[model samples]
Target: MASVNTLPGMAPTLAGKTAYVAICGLGMAADLADGLEAAGARVAIITDDTSCFASRSGVEAAFAAVAERVGPADLVVHAAASRALCGAQKLTSFGEAGFRCADTALRATLYALQAAHGQMAGRGGAIVVLGPAMSLVGASNLVPLVTATEGQRALVKSGARQWGRCGITVNWLAAVSELFAAELAGMDPGGPELGEACALGRRPQWAMDIAPVLAFLGSDAGRSITGASINMDGGEWMTP
Candidate 1:
């Protein structure tokens, strides 16, 4: 039911490519994996939230094992939700726990990049970070998640700039988190009101609206777009 294989015309031929789906949340990770697989990439999924935040060596080891089990990763799609529901805290109530939530997100992202770079550095590949649309527009009661979202965005740009010479592209795709059911809310909270729809006048469908975009980004056609923060919010939140 995901969007990857349902698209018309020639699908991206990621033949012989090894891709990693690293996610903290479970909403669309399975669908995304199916999408990549439909496009011909050998996919490995890393859903262990604790391994990434625990220590440097652990993440490196975990990632290395995956590459060995499958093959060196040619692409990585990441979404950060490192803890159980790391969002929806009132600003006045924000505390050390809030900071820890933010830290987990940042730490997970950095590890993803570091591990992906270790594998893709000399070989050259793509790294796509999935973010929450609310990060583009501030959301109430989600200050920490927002902070981590933007922080990850900065990392994307930095990785793009530094890794461009190596043929590695880093970009962030801000999706409509509402579509992922309850699984993605920890990363993306405070969605629009019932009446507040996108410019397109509706919420995006995962298979119909969003998955196709990821298919494109993971393909060779999207090589030119790097260090970009694209909001696929059904135009609900337009970037000014």
Candidate 2:
């Protein structure tokens, strides 16, 4: 359980906001929800069911029902991912298994983004998704999942460009795959850093490394920042 230790007067507070976390496979999102709550947003986690994220309509229906049950959201977050890793051709040989690993993540991202647009239309809000750093530096034999994550990055730009007119900010948060228990997909945990020594010489902690960034994105401070990939991997993965 995540504790409710909200900062009284914070700059990035989502005070008076409702953050709808359209969770898929990001390990329950409990702590992340706590961070949103700390920022003063009432957090509602929806849809861990695979079927709910299987298609665009499924995502839309879930969002619609949630809105009716609760209310429209001021922000939406989708950080769907998998811990599994595989080779490209091997996945291809396995058929849907490989594609599922890749397709599911990207498709769910699209579903959440599409549903969020409808839910926050006219009112305006923010949408954020997690994309693996593997999108930049491909992981060994981890092509399918990497493809999906990189596709998500492109979609972030696409969504932001189109939705900016609607007062919506869409951005991608870049993270090391290890954060999602992607041990094989990320830098080897027990060995030296994969490429170069980490500038920070450590991995990112969910609270210390990631939540603050999410808090800022959910706050007024991040309203104008959109369509960009913000790296939060403890300096292990840096991009220009």
Candidate 3:
């Protein structure tokens, strides 16, 4: 669905660098894949909907589709997630069903990350995970999401710590703003002033805004930065 542009003499600078992205939500998967390609990196994608875990076959097909144009290298972004937003009242009143759904997202991401990590360890590459900003604070109406977010942060830290020595750097792309712009399109979206007392009173961010940061973290420039959670949100959410 994405169109490719020819740049006469300007081949991609990051071309031939191969990267596999899994669990891309909505259209962001395709967007990130295309960005990686523009940078000269070969890209392959696998969504959770595929039957075989990370959908290795799907990724292979992507590589084949662009094989003649750009070669492949090494990198993977493991990010499979489902809506785990359960109103706090329900979470506290009911049992585990809601909580389980939320927890599953973290586990799913871990499974995909581990699979990708194996391949990266074999080739020495970078791993990036798409994490949520809700993980940074407690939203009374959204307990399930909060749990999953925090759990993911923990996973990123552990993954980076264990894999850093293997020539693989793992980190979380913590979005300081709402990366889900499409969903908020007709909602008459408001700025941080709406939630000032709760968060740091900052504005939400678009998905495109977060893409560049993710691309940077997955590049060689971010090679030395591992096990760190980089906030892409404005100064809205800060530590005291």
Candidate 4:
């Protein structure tokens, strides 16, 4: 997919920062990586053997392999998520799949936070966790995925509360389904129109829309922001 241009008012100012992005294989991941790089942040991609989120040791090992490269990372974005989309009946028929999906999404996030926390223990830094916008607006055939994404949001909040004293901030970013090909394919054809569903009245620009948010969260500008869920779906789901 072609990379979208950075949005107006979003410039590259993360010159000496290092960002470690886990493997999610989504267009958003690539876009965020590109945006971070464009902002002058040294970007490191960690994709070696991170698929097995069920194994904590395995996940830790994967992060450990790139430990040196991720030294004191200024930003750690956990975009890796299981894309298993199934109907509610399918969830009941094969409960294991649901468990696996949750395990993959939640554990991978926990592991990433652990690794990033260790690196940013003394110093302050930002960690961004990506979730699907459907998690907030309950789409059909997406219970497992929604559970996992919403659970990760809770994790981000708890981590933010606990790690704030250590000068570490944790936040969640909810992106539209366009970023995830699988989720997009499974979306209901008769669903509400994007413009009608979102207050902004337009589909989101996956890369262009999310890159600046990631950059801001990873920069000092977002230091005071923690335990917050920033919706990147153009006001698709509002939270009071």
Candidate 5:
């Protein structure tokens, strides 16, 4: 594979590595797969199209099949969270959609982490969970998504602590919505301005801005860094 520079001074950090990306249908997932491949990591996609995320056993079996096809993965990227946008009403509304959304996002992520951990038990690897930064700042109509993403962040920290001895590193990347620009275009004329809300006064470049961070976390360079949340949403939200 031809080596491409994923970041300055990195020299193809993922060279010769194998990455298994879940939820390939998402724009972020597709970008991640492409970026990983460009950096010399062989990529394999795992999605619900062929597997069910409704149960732990199903998720485990799906990952097992992927492992059989790709040998052992050096990095597992879990980008399977729900992207359904709903208002606060949905949070308090008596409906199964909210429950199902949370179930798919949180449960699927947990199962992916477990499956990856099991596969890399003795030998170590990296697990990157892609989440929304909106969870950090909180949004009016995204309660369920925020709950699941924040919960996933907490799980990453716990997983890092639990699996440190096994050499596994778990981290979360909080990204801006890939649809930010398009959504802004459809915003009401009287709505708040997107640029003014962000300190940087601009939205982040969807995949290009995030892929390098993933490459670093999945590489040996980031072995010392784990149990952390890296905010990749430009200056939308700041944390000390």
Candidate 6:
């Protein structure tokens, strides 16, 4: 893990780099960790929804796998239990339960940001939050998620402004997909809708496709870019 492992022609962008934090604990985060390691950067900590971890334990196990390759991280990515996309109508209909859900998402992101910023105080590092496009483009049922995700975006901007001086870059990536089974998918409030809403007749993005952008944001190539929401959704939304 310490050695600079590169292919015959593949250059290392994060080679010998140190420190990174991953929140959400999804397949994307796992892929990001792999990309970072391949670039020679080591992940320091990871956090995710505890229930999700407890349900399958695969998420936590992924972090453990990374630790085996690289050294331990300082902070974990603890994600707050919240949906990805909450519509405006849903927000209106949301009672205490809705607020709680939204709060979880907001608090999770904030906690991760706080932890990562604190760890990077002296030496400096990178922080990437896994976000969805609906967070920026709010729909009817995406109220709770929209509220929380909006706050997260704002936090990213503020973090960049406040932490850039410390050499810590704060950024996030948004992926668009109808096939994702996460609660934040925003396609339905009932069950997972794999591909019933695609007007363009294209397959939803796989988690792997978005990993590189996140890796870039966590790498040297994204040093100058902070407090920005980079989208990895193939032409889904581009208002950012």
Q: Rate the local accuracy (lDDT) of all candidates.
A: 0.74, 0.72, 0.58, 0.71, 0.70, 0.54
Q: What would the TM-scores of all predictions be?
A: 0.87, 0.84, 0.73, 0.85, 0.84, 0.69
For candidate 6, lDDT tens digit of each residue in 1-240?
222233322245556665444555334445445545655555554545322332224444544555566644432332333543243345556777677767766766666666555556786667766566656666556566666767777877888899889887877665563423354443563432222243444533432344345556656666788777776555555555
- The better candidate by TM-score, 1 or 6, is 1
Residues 24-76 of candidate 1: C-alpha lDDT, one tens digit per residue: 64457677777677777788878774355355577677788898799888888
Ranked by TM-score from best down, the candidates are: 1, 4, 2, 5, 3, 6
Order candidates by lDDT, high to low: 1, 2, 4, 5, 3, 6
Weakest 10 consecutive residues of candidate 3 by summed lDDT: 180-189
Positional deviation of 171 in candidate 6, in angstroms?
1.3
Ten residues in sequence with the least summed lDDT for candidate 6: 1-10
**Candidate closest to the true structure, highest lDDT:** 1
Query: Mind giving the per-residue lDDT tens digits that candidate 4 earns over 169-189?
Result: 999888765455344444554
Show how many residue pairs clash in every candidate, following the order shown.
2, 0, 6, 0, 0, 15
Against the correct fold, how does model 2 do in TM-score?
0.84
User: For residue 87, what is the lDDT in candidate 5?
Assistant: 32
Comparing 4 with 6 on lDDT, the higher-scoring candidate is 4
Poorly placed runs, candidate 5 (over 4 Å): 1-10, 83-89, 94-96, 178-202
Off by over 4 Å in 6: 1-11, 19-21, 25-27, 49-89, 177-181, 184-186, 189-208
Global local distance difference test of model 5: 0.70
Question: Any residue pairs clashing in model 3, and if so which?
Answer: 14-39, 14-40, 14-41, 15-40, 18-73, 176-233
Model 5 steric clash total:
0
Show pairs that collide, candidate 4.
none
